[model samples]
Target: MPQSNTPVRDRLEEILARLDARRDRERAYVKLYTESARAEADAADRRRQGGATLGPLDGKVVSIKDLFDVAGEPTLAGSIIRRNAPPATKDALVVKRLRDAGAVILGKTHMTEFAFTAVGLNPHYPVPGNATDENLIPGGSSSGAGVSAVEDTCDIAIGSDTGGSIRIPAALNGIVGFKPTASRIPLDGAFPLSPSLDSVGPLARTVTDCMLADAVMAGDPMASVVARPIAGLRIGVPQGRLLNDLAPEIAKAFADSLDRLARAGARIIDCRIDDLMERLWGATRIGSIAGLEASRIHADWLSDDAALADERVKGPLRRRLAVPDEAVAALLETRRALAVEMDERLSPYDLLALPTTPIAAVPIASVETDANEYDRVEGLLLRNCQVANQFDLTAITLPMPGQTRPAGLMLMGRNGADRMVMEAALSLEALLRNS
Candidate 1:
């Protein structure tokens, strides 16, 4: 059992002080469980004094995305529409797991309404500003989770990534985000963006922190993860669509990361998987499983005459309703076939690396004012990460080294190969930090 010299109550008080100082400016938390967290920390302190600790995360404060149920609270999913919804009778399975492991719940964080867009602008709640620059948009859906982690308000922030939500915010905020295979963690009470793609994961300061949170969520024993050496590791870089149209800063950071890995004796291969890319893109264009499922989830709410939901969410759902059943069936088939082909193509390599986002964080004012720019930037941000979700793969975004603006180097692996991706990320993280 690992122990911290700092008392849990003391740590919680320190975090509360920081939260108090920044609350008006950051707007990171939607609901602060200050009273409950204090109680938990005092309990942890008693256990510590008795020489008994819960686990690795005992006394650690963590934030949950508003998408998850928290017993008596109405799971907001960052929407005013859900304000009248009934309270959850029990904790979400993931929340219960975290509590059982001795993690203090620090309250829910804000997100894009229904986790709809890649750009994290909430018309209802105050949108959390980017951790690096207040002017920039904090990457979507998991916006507050990333902000909270980056701001040191919590040890970990649990968020759901359906289409780059977790990784996007993490990248823009210069922290580590991991999206595990959908099945690795149960989604019993998580509000769905796309049941097919929604995955519960963590955004944290280090790869090891993510691994610990992931283990607790997955109901697995926390195990020491040894980093796989970068030497002799086969890493592939997709050449065509993924690498196209990279912003100068993003390109430079990505290229520099590749150079470091190559110098470390890793085999960096230029892979051309245009057919798979085409298939994936086709499915996205035709109709998303996310959009289809979202339509179904909100059908009753959308049916009301009053404008209850945001247009950004309503517009997509309305479009999804027009999509024929045949089109959805065809898209599912295409998605399945492409997943198989993509796995086979990537089997030879330990991981595939790409620029997490083609562009860096855009100014919040720019996107909020210009709808066209918002659409273009949102599509680009979700482009690379969408492939991993559609292909049912595990992926991670690691912050690149020595850049004025934060950029991320993404490593994606096969569906069940989460540990492999984490190990590789650990090694890569070391390289980035040392460089």
Candidate 2:
């Protein structure tokens, strides 16, 4: 919501200066599109001088997650194995849309290897540090995308969400992230983790920025989001295991957020969404959709040389290969049925609110050294966000107020209700800011 009268190129230079200053400590970008970005900024300035502008994001710096294609660059996707992969002949559809909107392409940000893990740990590349605490893990696979926005390297970060990649990093880094309904954004040219669940979205400082970026990426008309009256909004709080485990700080922060909403006239109702949760758990039981899809994509590469991948990823990849075909079929059927059930369940409420993650960001050292701890933390981090992905709902994570550790209050709406979700998020964000 902050506006600057400075020239686009000038502001970009200032951001570049800051990026250079912290280059040694932060690994937010795997590639820097300096020349192209400067050229784009100059063009934006020319457009402004001619009294013609692209839109709200014209001349804004935006970073892409490595999974998305950029012409002339190999999409490494945070993996050394893909270092020798062929360069993309053209930009991904979303990337092309960003360019068409007059956004300055900052560069491709780092991510988890093939976006396999929730905890952003890349043995091949320097792991991007947490925006809030360097000692903590930056939630990933879209690790650098979140850090790029938090660090002011870009105005917004374009990222993908399969199972909380965008929201987890946003929650951990204390930023805003939006995952629209899967069908809202085209996925052509993006490296897939799960064709069934992948959705392209943005991470930024405010819900407005995300709304603008989402519109641009989807090729939809830019529309203003008027915050709905909070007093009349019906918000459902799922009363189940989703709310069970919480770090003291996170639990307190979430409770206080709900209390603030209630005081502002929002009707907060405790509801049971057991059927929705059960379907999600069942669909993901045999092998993750992402893991299965990733296995198929990487079959030849893994077969040739397993040593190319990190040990942590190799184990999961192998397990995905062993899943029974019958199990996958059953899970897919359950997923289809549950998607409908979830929509019906959520139709009564404006939104469903939950803690973005059960715990705060874990120390990078803890997860890196202990595999068991990594598994436990990964599950906890992905649990709440993955529900939206499985049920095909649009979701957004808003940073919670008064938290010593970063925590996110997530708002989820019915599938294809992305605009509604964003408007509600704007209202909630305003309430939190005032409180």
lDDT of 2 at 227: 72
Model 2 regions lying over 4 Å from their true place: 24-26
Cα-based lDDT for every prediction? 0.89, 0.89
Off by over 4 Å in 1: 1-3, 22-26
Model 1 clash count equals: 0
lDDT of 2 by residue, 340-388 (tens): 9889988889899999999989899999989899999999999999989
Q: In candidate 1, what are the lDDT values of residues 1-435, reduced to their tens digit? A: 124788888888888998888678657898999999999999888998999988878888899999999888788898999888899989999999999889999989989999988899989887788988888999988999999999888999999999899999999999999999989999998988888889999999999889989999999876676798999999999999888889998998899999999999999999978888776777768567888878878887776768668888998898897777788778878888888998999989999999999988989999997989999999999999888888899999999987787878999998899988998899999999999
lDDT for predicted candidate 1 compared with the true structure: 0.89
- Displacement of residue 48 (Cα, Å) in model 1 is 1.6
Clash tally, candidates in order: 0, 1
